[model samples]
Target: MKKRLIVGISGASGAPIAVELLKALRDTGIESHLIISHGGACTIRQETSLSVEEVQALADKVYAQVDIGAGPASGTWESLGMAIVPCSMKTVAGIWSGYSDNLMLRAADVTLKERKKLVLVARETPMSPIHLRNLQELSMMGAVIMPPVISYYHHPQSPEDITRHLVGKILDQFQIDLPQFCRWEGEPHV
Candidate 1:
């Protein structure tokens, strides 16, 4: 099978990041297997002009989030890893506890079991103590808990630019490069 990356879209504020990530994956010729949770579908409608179907089109394959038997739910499916963009706290808790109630969570669980990369763009502000603890445990378990925190050093001019930069950073965890991703250079000599 071609190189594959599982992309999970959960309900969170940064839906645009997920959209851009899909577009980037398409541009790089990576086969993207997408799974959008019910909350994710709602977030797409609320946050972006594109419908969930439109976003799904960017991926090479789309799986229903409710389908727990989906290809990504099994370790045998084989993939570079899984990325949950705009991951909600609920989804994080689900994965941290191995509560594979849906395909997205199940895929994450499988990724951890297979010792594959599981990058979570956790999108929440002022994370509660519970959130921090869960995230800490997940990090200890080897999942990359990358919240969508902005980097001013990149000098992002617009929201899209920020989103792309964040997506690039997430892809970096998988060793995938986004051509437009700007790397930070140290201060210029006086």
Candidate 2:
């Protein structure tokens, strides 16, 4: 069966990561259920040529950020996992505090409560103690607190290359194998 993944895009600056993740999922024949926050919508327009509609069109299913009634908000809904690419610090805090004000937070909360994989591509830098504590809490709760740290081992040559590498790492946490990028080996390439 095709795996169902919940893709949440928050208002983080790295919108390209979310875009590439969605495209990778589509390319890999996985079903994506997406939720784009208002800030995410703005960042996409600011960062990419693709329109918000074009991005939403890539998903098998799309939910509004405020749609707490969405299937992803229910633990009973069978999904492989959820990934929040370019996860905002605000969203991370919300998840840490069990604040399900929006669908993204609610879905993440559900993913945690259901003991499913929750991958967060956190995007903040020079984080405060609060941020670190929130990440710690989420980590304790089984959420993968991944950041957008790219590896140079693959010899990335472009923005797309970098994005693919990071997305591949995110998918790795979910055990979704895709040929998005090459794994690192500590040997010099000839």
Off by over 4 Å in 1: none
Model 2 earns a TM-score of 0.95
Report the number of the highest-lDDT candidate. 1
- Kindly list the per-residue Cα lDDT of model 2 for residues 1-190, writing each as its tens digit: 2499999999998999888889888998889999999999999999999999999999999999878998999988989989998899999999999989999999999999999999999889899999899998899999998999978888899988888888889888877786846986668778
Q: Which tens-of-lDDT digit does each residue in 140-159 have in candidate 1? A: 99999999998998888999
lDDT of 1: 0.93
How close is every model to the real structure, measured as TM-score?
0.97, 0.95
- Highest TM-score scorer: 1
Worst 10 residues of 2 by lDDT: 177-186
Model 2 residue-pair collision total: 0
